[model samples]
Target: MSQRPRPCRWLRRPGSDLGLRLTLAAAAAVLLLVPFTVLMLLVATAWPPLLALDAHLAATLHAGTSANPALAGVLQLWTDMFAPGPLRVLVGVVAVWLWWRGARRVALWAVVTMVAGGLLGAGLKLLLGRDRPEFLDPVSHATGYSFPSGHSLTAALGAGVLLLIFLPFVPDASPVRTQRATRWTIIAAALIVTVATGLTRVALGVHWLSDVVAGWTLGVAVIAATTAAFATWRGLPARRSPQGGSGRPPPRDMPGRT
Candidate 1:
């Protein structure tokens, strides 16, 4: 008698690869880091035992109060407005708005990333109720808490969100050359800005390094969640067409079509 065939796996589903990447990103950002951030925040807030870290850092800054204002002031230039973070987010938003144009789906997510990141950062700040450094008058002041640096969170979330937003269109299915370049270029740029903003806070003495770390973690988590949702939404079964060869299709199905 003929042997029975093995059951088919669900590996060949549409967007499966993209789904996997999304899953990986989510796990890395949320599972691995977010909880740790929460713990750090708690330590920074509840564990009066841990509160000693803040005290120590505060003392260090105080000791060096006259160290170098001119240098800090220079580094503090454009970064103070959160341009290092939100500015990049804005660039990503513009990409979606310009290239994707009327494509509501893409545009909406860019907006979602910017708004959600801000909200999450603020919410965490208030929830933790961690105070800002008393070392100097804040170049900027936020009324809420400050365990996780909002600038860092904003930067990380912006980076992650934009990366995911464009991941599906990376030209893998159709084999385009520049798609990979463009995708990577965007990712690299985002990382630079995100990291810079986080570090800026530390240099400004506005927040401790721990705050930046936590904010970065949470920001990454937010993007992961967004990516998973986007991938799931796009992963619904759809037949691939080989009619087009240059990565994207002809203008037929696009806006100006009959």
Candidate 2:
């Protein structure tokens, strides 16, 4: 009789995979904190050069968009679609689906990342107490301290959560044409939504370039940190199973499974 495959030892104890998890955590921290810290300091001090650039870009985009009604309308529509509220709702639905599918860790990660990103952005905003740029003829308005754009942060968090959770299901090499096409399509779509969400906030006169940039950085950091934690929980070198390559524990080993 053939022997059953042994469970990966690393998955059972986090200490076994300490080095890899620490590396991932450190890299994520540096990427998130270094530039984000510098940006915060510059904004706090109201650095002349940074402020000038912020004002110039904000004004230029506002002017161009104001002149072209159709372009402005499009930007507005894009922003509304990816706004924090809608993104949060979408993430919530995704979390529910993941939970039902028995990928509980992934579902929890998604919720935690999204909530953490939003709270971080909101906390920083209150700390800085920054004001939104004022335009004589404003194309749009957002109420909040504007050092970090909420919409951008939410979009990035939502997109990152969905991408990481679903990516493992998409085969790297598939014989089916539709399956192969979907490989890159998901990644490209995520990028477009995240980037466009930030751009629209600036173009709409609702947020500064720095605000949008900070949001993107913070959101990505939260996603990375949470993802690393979950990866550590599940162990590295994810198991391959009939369902697909997944970080999730095998259904047979899962809690409450028969």
Candidate 3:
């Protein structure tokens, strides 16, 4: 008699499936909650911890301005690179490149994520109507409501989308260890860029510390949600053509079929 096929080994692995399920659930929770928290904080104007942290950070950064004019100037330049116009241009270029390479799905994902994140940030700014930091001299000048730093949000989204698009290109070997290492390296580099961009806004005194923090958190939520959506799409079963048949020959009969 024929025996039943063995269950998938991954399903039998201890904790792996549970861990992934929990992680995804937590990410969804954060994605839903962070924006609401930011909005409520803006309305209440009573986020004591964030307020105190903002005051201390802004004061510390401002105090260093005279002693480190050159450093301040460098940070100003870095912060400017994340401005909305520059970020739009950068995203446009990347999306076009991905399209040319036939990564249509990823290209569309990038454009949608960037545009949605920008609109969300802008809507928040207009709705909140919070003013920029004026407690100390600003190393750089800006205009507009400043509850969320647009530069920080754009930087995080751009860096994150690019990383996600390129991650699949890292080759996986049999052991899987090398692939994990490569992915971690890319993650580390992206984190550095995102963190530096947020910190520069604070150092320039154009945004309160809380604004940058909120921007980073919101940006991360957008990225996490986008990634989850993409993964779900990719996991879906492929559909047959209108003829009700697969377009390709049976895998076992195809040349070099795995």
The numbered model that scores best in lDDT is: 2
> Global CA lDDT of candidate 3, please?
0.70
Write down the worst ten-residue block by lDDT for model 3. Answer: 4-13
Instruction: Candidate 1: list runs displaced more than 4 Å.
Output: 1-14, 37-41, 48-50, 55-66, 81-103, 136-143, 163-186, 237-258
In the range 52-133, model 3's lDDT, one tens digit per residue, is 7777898788778646889988888877776767877887897887666545556666788798889999998997888787
Error of 2 at 13 (Å): 10
Off by over 4 Å in 2: 1-18, 176-181, 235-258
Off by over 4 Å in 3: 1-26, 29-32, 35-43, 173-182, 232-242, 245-258
Model 1 steric clash pairs: none
lDDT preference between candidates 2 and 3, better one: 2
lDDT of 3 at 207: 85
Q: What is the Å distance of residue 81 in model 3 from its true position?
A: 2.2
lDDT (tens digit, per residue) of candidate 2 on 152-217:
889889988777766556643557787767857988999999999999989999899999999888
Candidate ranking (TM-score, best to worst): 2, 3, 1
